[model samples]
Target: MSYPNPNPYGPPPGQQPGYGYPQQQPPSPYGAYPGGGMMPGAPAPYPTVMPGGVKAARVMLFVLAGLNLIGLIFAVMGLGSVSKASKNASEYTTSDAMTAMNVGKGLLIAVIVVIVLFIGAAIMLGAQFGNGGSGVRVGTIIFGVANTLVSLLSFPFGLVHTVLGILIIVFVSKDDGTAWFNRPRY
Candidate 1:
């Protein structure tokens, strides 16, 4: 009779080598990515961490929201004043006074609506920075453009908004910001 193989690592005679060892898979034809499992020539994966510029943009968004809140408060106060002025104007029979009052009230209401929208957008976009996708990037750019334009109307106080909006646009439009927003979630 034949004796068993002397080497413990080797398979016994008449038995397959896989009996006690794992089988090796054939090498893939394509080269592996640096992280492995990825196909060759694919774009590099985005970074997992939030980039500095993106973080700064997010912070600026929140700040812009805060400023918008202040504007909302002022607009509301102005609306109240307009209502009072309109009431006093109603005492006069002249259509001119009434027309002016109505116009002032309408303008104040419009300003309030716009301020509310700006505040909502700033908070929503700022909060989404952690998990937001490319849409967030696009939304931010649009928001920046709008903010800059709106700030032009207010001049002195809006100067702050204009500066912040410009900075946010710059930060979010950079390469690192794009990568952060494009990064795969999960």
Candidate 2:
């Protein structure tokens, strides 16, 4: 008669370790820390490093902010010129000239406001790239789209903005971008 098996939890004699039972999963190659490996039905962990595409998008955002800063300076200068022209036009008492000056001043003010807002948004979103979540991703995408549309109005001069915006959109919308933004904070 066969002797009783010493290890009752192990496979039967003459059989492989998993032969008459469910197989055990191998240990994780990444070690036993959290996010080291995915469980059987669990979602995969986010990458530890930021993806290239996301980095590119972040750079684009900063570039856009810089460009807007330049535009803001020019717009302010233009507003000053318009104010000076309004003062000169007032001496002549020409309603037409004054009307034109007022319109120019209004438009310039509007441009300055828009540029400031865009610059603020671009800088804020760019700074958030390192630790921001999906909301940041969505905000960046929206910023890119808006920049692209605005660039279209400026044509050749805005070519740089157009290209940067498109690149930002593409880079931030990729799978790696999604993963970066969705990564666990802790």
- Best of the candidates, TM-score: 2
Q: Candidate 2, TM-score vs. the true structure?
A: 0.77
TM-score of each: 0.75, 0.77
lDDT of 2 by residue, 1-186 (tens): 999999998888878775776677666646566876654655456777888899889988998899889988999999999898777664657788788889999999988988999999999999999999999999999999999999999989999999999999999999989999998897
Residue 51 displacement (Å), model 1: 1.3
lDDT of each: 0.88, 0.88
Candidate 1 off by > 4 Å: 1-45, 90-93
Q: Once model 2 is optimally superposed onto the true structure by TM-score, how far is the C-alpha of residue 52 displaced, in angstroms?
A: 1.2
List per-candidate RMSD values in Å.
10.3, 5.9
Candidate 1 clashing pairs? Answer: none
Residues 28-122, model 1: lDDT tens digits: 54435455564655555687778889999999999999988988998899889878877866454588878887898899999999989999999
